[model samples]
Target chain A: MPDAGITAFADWIATTSLSHLIAQKLWAIPAIQSVHIMSLAIVFSSALVVDFRMLGLMSTGQPLSAIARRFLPGVWIALIFATISGLLLLIAEPVRSLPTWEFQGKMLSLLCVIILTLSFQKLIAARAPAWDAMPGVPAGAKLAALVSIVLWILIIFGGRWIAYHAG
Target chain B: MSITEFLQALESTAFATAVREGAILFPFAESLHVVALAFVIGTVVFVDLRLLGLASRNQPVTRLTNDLLPWTWGAFVLAAITGLSLFSSTPERYFTNTFFRWKFFFMFLAGVNMLVFHFVTQKNVKEWDNDPVPPTPARVAGALSILFWACVIVFGRWVGFTL
Candidate 1:
């Protein structure tokens, strides 16, 4: 049950001019990696704050909606930068990335996180005000926060492992 | 003793020796370093964004800083501890790495930037505590803080790859 289309896309990415430029330029990889890590900090930190709020950890004085409103936009922006940087890195070394189990895990984790993040955003939009008014977080919100924490840790670990175990 | 001797001696200490030799412990420390990084920088970004009048506009700057500083400091302590452990494992390498020097330089600048903001621009914080856009000096400090921290993260990562 291999996906021919996905494999073909990966092949095309490897042969692209953009990939060649990235691989050949010494500064390009480090510069892109620097931006990638910075964007990672921004997105991950923003999401961590929201998750903490959900778990009743910090910023308890502020409305969850207010905190989310303030941080989620930055999260979205940073996520975009991170994705582009990540794509460039992957394309530049498609042979290394495409065949690695850790890379596959990282991609799968990222996809799951994207889904979870969108749903969490919707949940925050609809219920954050109520949750803020309540004395304690509802069980469901806390559960979602826990799931987010686990998923994010897995994603981070997968990212690190990919480097150590790259093909 | 020479600096080299000092670093080599430090590297051979029980704690440093244990961290370097322990399979699980070194990796665990690295994970802590990353987690602590998120906590420390994330909190600083929140405060800096507020100072720049880019986010949390309705909230008073002082209150926002007060709320976030405690967490920032707590995370920083953890980061410092783990960072020191990592350094001790290979003190001479970090000492000689140019990226490491640049990382330290930016970290020092970030500290000075914070101190200047607190002692100077923050003297009349209440006057524009809720201003959608803070005064020029506060905004400058915020902007500088962001720049310094960004450099710190960049060079810090560079040290990893270069070493």
Candidate 2:
């Protein structure tokens, strides 16, 4: 089936409608764009802080939990922006974006990131003693963090290129 | 094959077919690109601002950049690859696009700007040079760096509008 066919496959029916509805709402488009940028700031800044820790360049001495606690707010904040921005963008042109290849690739990678981040939260970071022990970051934990970081990076680039793709 | 042919080769392949078909796979790729770009650019701006004395004044410039360099490089490398991938799908269209033309062109200048910063100004940091306020030359370079990146983003944003 073609891309249009896939959207009509019943499973994608809800997603299709949601995208169309959002795209049609004129006021929502710019609002989401603003939110998306704000969220991006939080996400990127917070992640870089952790990345620095992973490489052992900076030590706050407060522990990984503390750092994570502080930055997590940022992560969530940025995520909200991303979601809102994405939704609004989708709202503007659901059928067009719904069928595009870049849009699908972005979604798949996002799923992989979400799963990894949630699954590893406890194992990589839960077992520490405050400033004394810090988070007992495992190799796997660091690896997960690293992967999450890299994937997010790719997602943004791809997202920007979507418009170019259509042209 | 010509360079253009090598790049456009993807347009003629199954991937392109799937993309044209608007499969789930294509949208996912596009998302990844946007996310990566924000991370990379955000990181670069963060580091660049620190260099120019915007924030992170207590930290060493050399350390700031060196520490974050890998992430920056990672972002750049991935952005370039994905960009090439994107270009592959529409060689002629992009080749003729004014914004596309400026994007690659400015992207090149930004890369050069980065290189010049490291080689030229980075050398002075180790010599007990502390400038809560950057010196004249450093300030100039810093100003230039900031402007260049802003253009990179501005031009990048407009690429969509114009193209």
Candidate 2 DockQ vs. native: 0.17
The DockQ scores of all candidates, in the order shown, are 0.48, 0.17
- Residue pairs clashing in model 1 are none
- Write down the RMSD of candidate 2 (Cα, Å): 7.4
Off by over 4 Å in 1: A1-12, B14-28
What alpha-carbon RMSD in Å does predicted model 1 have with respect to the real structure? 2.6
Model 2 error, position A152 (Å): 6.3
Best by DockQ: 1
Most lDDT-accurate candidate? 1
The DockQ score of candidate 1 comes to 0.48
Q: Report residue B37 deviation for candidate 1 (angstroms).
A: 1.8
**Candidate 2 residues B14-121, lDDT tens each?**
766665566454455555555556667666765666666775566666655665667667866776776655555566776777866776777677778777767886
What TM-score would candidate 1 get against the native? 0.90
